[model samples]
Target: MNHKRSLVRRTAAVAAAGAAALVLAACGGNGDSSAGHDGHTSKSPSASASASQGQHNAADVAFAKGMIPHHRQAVEMADLAPSRAESAEVKKLAEDIKKAQDPEIKTLSGWLTSWGEEVPTEGAMDHSAHGADGGMMTPEEMDQLKNSSGKAFDTAFMEMMIKHHEGAVAMAKTEQADGAYAPAKKMAGAIITSQTAEITQMNKLLGKN
Candidate 1:
């Protein structure tokens, strides 16, 4: 009987030890899983941040700086068309130009601000700074367009806008080629597409198509 008791006790002790080992193994497994979860959690924000902020370089900066003033000028010209253009088509085109560029100007300014760069002031440009490459209107040309009305205004506006858009297209192409910022490059692509189409339309309007 004493031997029987001792054997049973030993068996019970072995079973107890096995149970303890299993519990310890389960705890270790849980720890490993928790660690993996923690690692994944920490990595997610960095990935999202990279996606949201993206990367930028000097080319992107120049594109935004140059395009902002350029867009502002286009919008300025567009604003004149509503009051001065005799052609309904010209008025509609001007409205469309304003709608498209106003938002872009805001977006460009936001980018510049985020990058700690200067946003160009409203109605401000150093005409000598960009030269003909910018397709900017001279004060004399802008005054002429503003002072005219009817068919003359329509003709002058379309002609000048065509030139302005060509300059923007050039800048956008440069941005697509040289910029590192993903959003900026994407915007550049959009500008090329939309402005190219507009340029074709303007040429058609001018009977130059």
Candidate 2:
């Protein structure tokens, strides 16, 4: 009876050991799966952000490089409003343009710097055209604006700024379509919305609406 009882205890101990080993193995398998899932979750966003930051093409570069000077010119034009503008509304509109565009100029510069592209110098901006498509004023046109005052300044400023804002909107649209950087594309969208609104406002200010 003692030997039988001892044999029964030994068998029970072996069974318990087998059960514990199975539990441990199962836990280890689950731990590995959980770790793999966590790794994948962490990597997906990182990979997406990396792609967004690095995937820009020449069009993106052009957009940033071109916009810097464009915004600078707008700010310059806005600066003339305080002294030259006859209407309070025109002055306020100019102030609004400055408020909106100065930061955008800096943002465009930052993007170009991050992309290792050339940041356009103020003196080097192209200014020999006019239209809704990236239009810029010639030196003579800018001088004419500077030389004018009172209602003439207000009218010229409105007309010139309306054209300028249209150009920015065009550039912004191109960036929206082609820019790889998420931040840049977002800025582009913002530019389109704001500039389009400004264009409408300027048109109304000019009595075109």
Candidate 3:
């Protein structure tokens, strides 16, 4: 009877050991599964953001580079209206143009910097170098605008601004069609809407509408 009892106790001990080993294996498997789940969750947003930030293409680059200088030129023209322009309406328009384009120029520059592209020099393309490419005024035309005052200044400003806004609208359309970056495309859309309105307003002011 004593030997039989001892054998039973030994069998119980062996069974308990096997059960403990199985429990440990299950816990380890659950821990691994939980870790895998957490890793997948963490990586999903990172991958999405990486894709978004890396999505820009050549059209986006061109949009930024070209628009920066284009905007700068507009701002330059706008700056002259404060002391030089006679019409309150033209002055107000100039103020609005400056307000709109200044921030945009900064944004474009920031994008170029992030993309490892060289930002065009500020005030570099002040003349008509880009006249054929965009509706940029020639040095002589800018001088003529600068030299005029009162109603003459207003007329020249509106006419030149109409042309400039048209050029910007064209560029923005191209960007909307070709740009891969979401923010840039959105900006392009806004440009189209706002600049188109401004062009219409200028034409009306010039009695050309």
Candidate 4:
């Protein structure tokens, strides 16, 4: 009887916690720190988060190298939505993605700076462009997306972004497996968690989730 009663209590506690989480999401109390230096998230780091904290292997550097373009595409997509999306939810979500990620891109730049790694001149020199799922777009593809109209734009965005996110998840998985630093590993886990949710959100918006 004691064991049964304890199990019941634990179950009730879990259910209550889940309900509280739902309430928070519904209230738009979404909070994350370590997002771009905006109050939108609880913790956004600075652009100067230099990468030279210590020595790292080629794998960790490669992860950062590849992820930069992956993130850049995400920011580009988010930036495009203000003019493209008709749905308020989509627009709001896009704004949030840009605000959160723009600073993160800089944080990664800081890491590259500290590590004596060369940041890409623009969004080109994409590591993902070669292999990582062809995880990035060509300039022509980007142009096509830019000129796409209405629901056409929405459809393409969801399809391309879902694929894009999968590539980031792959990179994060690699980072977790091989990174020499704690911060890199932690950020990789965070990317996996955050992008998984955002991809789901995008799918739901497209009525595919």
Candidate 5:
């Protein structure tokens, strides 16, 4: 009977040792990099929620969302003169427009970031709100401008850009009146100032044409 009891105790000890070994093997024995009990990678739920959260109030969001397409058309007009223009003045104006507004686009982009809102990267905006502001040029207009050269190009650029500028000014006025955030409001004022000066220069050139 004592021999039988000793044999049973030995079997139980071996079973326990085997179970522990199996557990250890599962914890990265075969060069698996993940080794901890909490090995699955996941962001904290709170952090993910905050990532998508928008910081701006509705008014601010509307301004940024509205302004993106407005800026893009300005860039398009600025870009047209280099290939098609004969005049140094037209080319210089295009370069100036590119330099001035490209940074403003970045500035507005930073505004979106600080506001925790997505910048309207897609060039789709409801054009009904533009109100005599040629925020986004028609496909027909683009096609017409594309086919043009020299004097015609300058004419198309000036006409399109002046309308575009008017649109931007309207948006800026709305932002100033409605936006509470100081940085955004300041940007609106700056846009009005800089673009107004550029508009005057553009008008002067147009008079020559």
Candidate 6:
């Protein structure tokens, strides 16, 4: 009878050990699953951040590089208005142009810097050569603007600015269609809207509408 009891006790002990092992295995599996879930959650935010920073294409790069010099020329033209314009309306329009474009130039530069692209220097690119692309004023045309004052300056400013805004609209449209970067595309859309309105206003001022 004592031998029989001893055998039963040994059997119970083995069963208990087996049960404990099974519990431990289950706990280990759950722990690994939890760790995997946490790792996946952590990676999701990283992916989102990378997406928000945006991915640039060739068109996006071109838009930023080209717009910088184009904006610089517009700012230059607007700068002359304060000193040379005869009409209060013309002076205000120039101020508005400067206010709108200066920040845009900085934004474009920042995009270039972030993309590992070269930022164009102010007044470095010949505006005249860019006339086919950005409706840039030739050196002579700018010289004429600089030399004029009063009513003549206002009329010239209105006409030239209208053309310049039209060019910007064209570039912005191209960017909107072809650029890959989200921020750049958004900026391009804004340029199209604002510049189109400005073009209409300038035409009215020029008595062309």
- Screening candidate 3 with a backbone cut-off below 3 angstroms (N, C-alpha, C), the clashing residue pairs are none
Candidate 2, 128: how far from true, in Å? 7.3
Query: lDDT scores for all predictions?
Result: 0.90, 0.84, 0.87, 0.75, 0.75, 0.88
Q: Residue 10 lDDT in model 4? A: 100
Q: Which candidate is the best by lDDT?
A: 1
Could you give the candidate ranking by TM-score, starting with the highest? 1, 6, 3, 2, 4, 5
**Candidate with better lDDT, 1 vs 6:** 1
Question: What's model 5's overall lDDT?
Answer: 0.75
**Candidate 3 local Cα displacement, residue 54, angstroms:** 5.5
How does model 6 score by TM-score? Answer: 0.76
Off by over 4 Å in 2: 1-54, 128-132
Indicate the residue-level lDDT of 17 in model 3. 96
**Across residues 20-83, which tens digit of lDDT does each residue of candidate 5 receive?**
8898887646456654423533445546545654234566667777776677667777787899
The global Cα lDDT (0 to 1) of model 6 is 0.88
Please provide, for model 3 over 1-209, each residue's C-alpha lDDT reduced to its tens digit, 9 standing for 90 to 100: 99999999999999999999999998888887987878899998879866777588999998888888889888989988988888899999999999999999999999999888989997666434334647777778889988988898899999999888888888888889999988899999999999999998888888886
Location of the lowest summed lDDT over 10 successive residues in candidate 1: 123-132
- Summarize candidate 6's per-residue lDDT along 81-139 as a digit string, tens digits: 99999999999989998999999999999989877898887577655534575788888
Supply candidate 1's per-residue lDDT for 175: 91
Q: After superposition, how far is residue 19 of candidate 3 from its true place, in Å?
A: 40
Give a tens-digit lDDT track for model 1, residues 33-135: 9888878999998788679978889999999989988999999999998789999999999999999999999999999998899999887876665557788
C-alpha positional error of residue 24 in candidate 3 after TM-score superposition, expressed in Å: 26
